[model samples]
Target: MFKAVINVNYKPSVLDPQAEAIHKALGRLGDDNIATVMVGKYFELTLNAPTIEAANDQVERICDQLLANVNMETYRFTVTPLQGATA
Candidate 1:
């Protein structure tokens, strides 16, 4: 077993309305330390595969196919090996 984390975010060129709203709210609360905020998606998944390479492959496939919108969003992920598991 392996632990994977998938992070999806809007392309840098795109605008994020959610993040903008949060920024505005923070300013209202007198928090001006933040300069920019961006909204993104986070996913945690557990995958069963024989090796780290296989686990990474599976995560990449899912992210490319479904988790992220290639036209507007970009994604990154990390995989960690798990202990005491059998496939």
Candidate 2:
């Protein structure tokens, strides 16, 4: 078994409205050090496959198809075997 951890975030060049709002709110609260915030998505996927390579391939397909918006969002992930589990 394999577990995939996926994270998707906005492109740096794009402006984040939610972050700007929070930054302004922090300023009002006298927290000027708060520069910005980026909102993102996190996902954990479990797959039963013969090998890590196969599982990773499946994970990539899923991310490209659904988890990430290929135009605006970028995603990264890691694949690791489940601890103490039989294959």
Predicted model with the maximum TM-score? 1
Candidate 2 residue spans exceeding 4 A from truth = none
lDDT of each: 0.93, 0.89
Model 2 worst lDDT window (10 residues): 14-23
Q: What is the TM-score of each candidate against the true structure?
A: 0.93, 0.89
Expressed as tens digits, the lDDT of each residue in 1-87 for candidate 2 is 999999999889878788788888889999989767788899999889889999989999998999998788899999999997676
TM-score of 1: 0.93
lDDT of 1 at 20: 93
What tens-digit string does per-residue lDDT give for candidate 1 at 34-74?
99998899999999889999999999999999999999999
